[model samples]
Target: MGDFVLSGNVTRRENKLIPHWKGPHRVVVTNNGWTYDVQEFVAPFAIITRHIMRLKIFRDKYLGVTEDLWEYATYANGGHMVQRFLDCKMKFDTHQWEVLVQWRGLDEAENSWEPARILLEDFPLLLARWVRTDAKAEGMRSFVLNETSSRRGK
Candidate 1:
């Protein structure tokens, strides 16, 4: 088997509005009909088997498109590249909140989800924005609900 990238699922955190095409993982084994065992280098280097439907052939075009993705890959490959942060958000997850980031020189299509601790340490301003946006959204939602209830009572 060769190195292949894993496709992201639509339900992944911060991926709801974006395409999920993450990976370049090394293939550990190949199964029947486009399935392969792959390795994820994040954190503790976990191995996962994925179907060919979710895998793509790694290409050079995928690189240099976004700084965060490229830098993370470089680091994972034992290279050093300075990462620049552009924007951040706190996204609600099933169990907890997560940090979604927008990297410099990359559009909305390139923004990816990160851990909240990384935002706190590297980009506090984005964290503040996330808080403000959350508050504004909550306020608007409350106002709408109140108006609807009042109309129903009339």
Candidate 2:
């Protein structure tokens, strides 16, 4: 057996801040017992996004969350925020990253619906599909469509 490892990062898309956690994370991330990882993920955005604040035109425009809020990664130039926590020596199996992407999109849509129902209804699925396709381009195999449930088995 291998020791569990934790890695995390915070991401900003439009006005929302999403925290990402990965363990040698082969499955869903638990919501507790990973404060350090969560803190690391959120600290950067909390520090720099201060200056980017602006008043939101509509209370529920971009989802229920305030559009005026900014995140730490927003200060940087390109690429999404990524903090790799556990690169275990044991070779983890290659799995499709798209399913993860779709799952996240669905989760976000649910969270955002109350604040921004229009976006949840309009573009999230399209965005999720695009992200899934992008993950494929980055060398992840499609787990749901082609292979075994355990990515390691492949």
Candidate 3:
């Protein structure tokens, strides 16, 4: 696993933490050139972008009128075909699908060459746990941020 220095807070949209981030956070660029941000992010936030490639497929297959199919396929196929389609064609943005395609290829190449794993045996409590921060306890109404704090009480 790569080193992940505590970058900072991740913002949320619609009760979920956003995945795509800007600027220099903390990412290890793999040999293939696709970088993996080592910081711990809210689970399943990455899942949202899973269908980004599917959107490309749907756009290519069905044309622009129904990019929604990419999303629909995610539910229907149980998101199984996401990576397959992504590998075949990476489309983070249907408008500029080539960039996405290149990125996905780099990521794939890196992962295949040298895979990363959560070393549970090495660090028993490495996994992050969710914190119910939505409740400001004073935001006119309580709202928990979709984020995780270190299990260590600090």
TM-score against truth, every candidate: 0.38, 0.16, 0.16
Backbone clashes, candidate 3 = 7
Model 3 root mean square deviation, Cα atoms: 22.2
lDDT of 1: 0.51
Off by over 4 Å in 3: 1-32, 36-43, 47-59, 63-67, 79-154
Look at candidate 2 and give me any clashing residue pairs. Answer: 7-85, 45-72, 63-115, 63-116, 64-115, 64-116
lDDT (CA) per prediction: 0.51, 0.26, 0.24
Segments of candidate 2 deviating more than 4 angstroms:
1-6, 25-154
Candidate 2 residue 134 Cα shift, in angstroms, is: 32
Tens digits of per-residue lDDT, candidate 1, 7-120, equal 544554664445555555768887777677887645456788777777777655424334434344545355222233333333545442344455544677866766655444
Compare the candidates by lDDT and give the number of the best one: 1
lDDT of 3 at 111: 30
Q: Write the per-residue lDDT of candidate 3 for residues 57-104, one digit (tens) a residue.
A: 112232222223323322322311112221112234442211111122
Task: TM-score for candidate 2, please give it.
Answer: 0.16
| Candidate 1 lowest-lDDT run of ten | 79-88
